[model samples]
Target: MAETTNGDARGASEQGAGEATNPQQFTIQKIYLKDSSVETPGAPEVFTQSWKPEARVELNTRRNTVGEGLYEVVLTVTVTATVEERTAYLCEVHQAGLFTVAGFESNATDQLLGAYCPGVLFPYAREAVSDLTGKAGFPPMTLSPVNFDALYARQRQREAASAESADDQETDNPG
Candidate 1:
């Protein structure tokens, strides 16, 4: 009887240990340049202008579910540089990566995809933009490092605010 009791205790302990273990995973499957374009509309005439280039840069990130536990993140960057209020060059780059993520809650997964993955891809996109600018006869454009974590948090705040506003409107209308 004592032996039976001991065996049952051991089995329960083993089950508890198994239940407490966490199997979390994050892996980078691949990284690549998904798309890119460079245009020098001003060309020769723009080159003659003084090198006082005024540039505008826009950045965006998006994610897609590739398959079970697999995800794709794309970081898009656009740069337009003008000399003397005339267009000198325009560059756009899309850097993408495939990742395998699992064992996390939905919110955690979203953060990983929205912030961490894009952060990982930014350097590649930045380099591509710089290379494209240099190739377009302009100085290499060094993009400043981005804080994706902050961006993600801010985005979430905006979404929450928007939802609250919608809810308020619905409550007021009682529809």
Candidate 2:
């Protein structure tokens, strides 16, 4: 006859127990503006005259592991407006988010950190920058859509090409 006891049942339960897990484990640890700055050196006087101002935007992204499974993603955007050599406004915003990312593959993690995370945080940063610029006496500067995935891919390609060139140089020298 088979043994029927609490110990056996407990052992069976332990053997058949699924891995400890929770569906709601992943979460956004926190979201904050890491850094932000807006400058309008030529504000009142700069905006007084009728001059076509040109705007330039530069963006950069960085990611760092904060904990065992937590990561921080930061997106930095710099916007500058100039009217024929005179500076109208300059704005820099750094938006950051802390996310708990467990059980994610490297590619997926990279995609989240590189593209999706930034996409989620950019709107708030844009709004803050626009408000700052407007409050600085310049017209509200609306940022355009950014294809972060394409940008990330382009950056990777450039890095790979540079590495290949470096490797080719090393191979040719063989010194």
Candidate 3:
């Protein structure tokens, strides 16, 4: 136990020294709901039908650099519910966060902006969706938790595959 404690202390000291050379920083300046919209196109008539509504949910994430070492990440969630051929309710929420990240490699920063930051913002977006739906005279739409890391990995894989295919085509045809 004592050896483990000493080793941990040594590791901490080493990391501290490393941080001094290239200081790493990460902070969330603010998290807010950037935009939201709820529409109930078919109100009284749609509610009269059986409560069997087909719900479709779409989610997307985007990031942009606001300033040096500062970035804005937005998670957009859209939900539409329809009863038979009639529209029930449509809700959209854009949850955004301002993050400051420095001293990290490009890939790390991308991961932070794509996955980690969005992961932090997702719950708020989900809650907003549910709240909006409930307030629109419908049952709360409880959204399932998202696996941002897995989604990011899949997206990266698809991009890499596309690039490889483009490179292969170029090599095959030299015009």
Candidate 4:
């Protein structure tokens, strides 16, 4: 009986040691320019105008799980230039990056995709937008820094509040 117990303990220790030595593996499968467009309506003449151009920028980000541990993050940036309501140019760019994640659970993966990945991708996207706009005969547009983590937390809080309100409404209307 003592021999059997000693063997069992050794087997358990071996299993644990094996698990600890298992390598963490990950790879960036691909990174590509998903989409890009530059529209300059007042192209040739817009460059001659002495008036300062005002720029409006909009940004969006999304992520998709390509495989078990592979995820693709897309950052979309749109910039529009106007001189007192006269459209000068519009440029939109979608830059994407592929990432491999290991040892993270589902919720953790989601947070990484939503916040961390976007944060990593934003700078490249911003630079691309600025370069495109500059080549399109407009002033370089610098994008402001984005706090994706705070944005994600705020979204989660809003969702929870909305769900609670929905539950209350359902209870009030129950026949």
Candidate 5:
């Protein structure tokens, strides 16, 4: 918390000229499971086979602005378990949250929504996936923690590289 020493009402606004007076803030208003599903096509047949199965995991994130300084971020996770080329089970979960973000520059805001918000939502999404797997009468499965910051950085790097390549191609062959 930051406190202003000046008591006068006008003193606050007079402190900074041509600058944003509001402090940066990021808050979570709500977190919930937007959607979830689990499938076991092999079912009883799968139970008869070996318990050793290979697991595949996928993750995605997206955001939308709903109001002034308010955003909705959704993290989707999918898991597929297979044994000997046969599908044991599949699961998908959409974990979503409403956040209030203010007093940040465009890039900072993007980082918050892209990396920080998804990080906050991941534990819930993991729990949902675990619950889904357990309810399907399979072993309790727990997903490893993800490094969203690294992922976001890599994505930004890829985008920058592609843009730079496009510019280079244009420079080489101007039409």
Candidate 6:
């Protein structure tokens, strides 16, 4: 009986060690430029204008499950440069990456996909926008770095507040 108990204990320990060695895995499968477009409608005329262009940048991120433990995260960046209220140029870039994230809870996975993935892809998107502007006969537009973590947190807060307000309104109306 004592020998059998000792053997069982050893087997459990070995199982635990095996699990430790093969811990939860997270990896990036690939990163690529999913799509990109540059529109210089004003073109030659805009180029002739002074270099004082007002630049507007919009950024968004989306994620979808590709397969088990695999997800596709796309970071879309749109840049529009205007001069004297006329359109100078418009560029959009969709930077995407395939990530394998396993052994994480739903909330953690959400954060990873929403914030961390976009943070990783932002620099590439930024560079693409800059290159597009430079290639469009204009100086490269330097974009400031974004804090995706903070943005994600704020977005979550707003969502929660909206939900709470909706619940309050429903209770007040009771219809």
Give the winner by TM-score. 6
Please list the Cα RMSD from the true structure of every candidate, rounded to 1 decimal place: 4.3, 4.0, 6.2, 5.0, 4.6, 3.7
* Model 3 lDDT tens row, 1-175: 9999999999999999998887878999999999999999999888777788999999899988999999999999999999987789999999999999998989998999999999999999999998999999899999999999999999999999999999999999987
The Cα error of candidate 6 at residue 38, in Å, is: 0.7
Which candidate, 3 or 6, would have the higher lDDT against the true structure?
Answer: 3
How does candidate 3 fare on TM-score? 0.87
Cα lDDT tens digits, model 6, 37-154, are 8998887898777778888999999998999999999999999988999989899999999999988878988999999999999989989988987887788877899999999999
Worst 10 residues of 3 by lDDT: 44-53
Cα lDDT tens digits for candidate 5, 59-125: 9999999999999999999999999889999999999999999999999999999999999999999
Check candidate 2 and list the clashing pairs: none
Per-residue lDDT tens digits for candidate 2, residues 1-175, read 2556877987877766643443223567888999999887886788678868999999888989998878899989899999878888889999899988777777777777888888878888888788888888777888998888888789879989999999999999999
Candidate 1 residue lDDT tens string, 1-175: 9999999999999988876796678999999999999999999998777788899999898888999999999999999988888889999999999999999999999999999999999999999999988888788999999999999999999999999999999999995
Q: lDDT for model 2, on a 0 to 1 scale?
A: 0.84
RMSD of 4: 5.0
Tens digits of per-residue lDDT, candidate 4, 49-168, equal 885888888878888888778888898888888886878989898989999987766777778878888788788888888898878766777899999999888888999999999999
TM-score of 2: 0.83
Candidate 5 deviation (Cα RMSD): 4.6
* Better-scoring candidate (TM-score), 3 or 5: 5
- The parts of candidate 2 lying over 4 Å away from their true place are 1-26
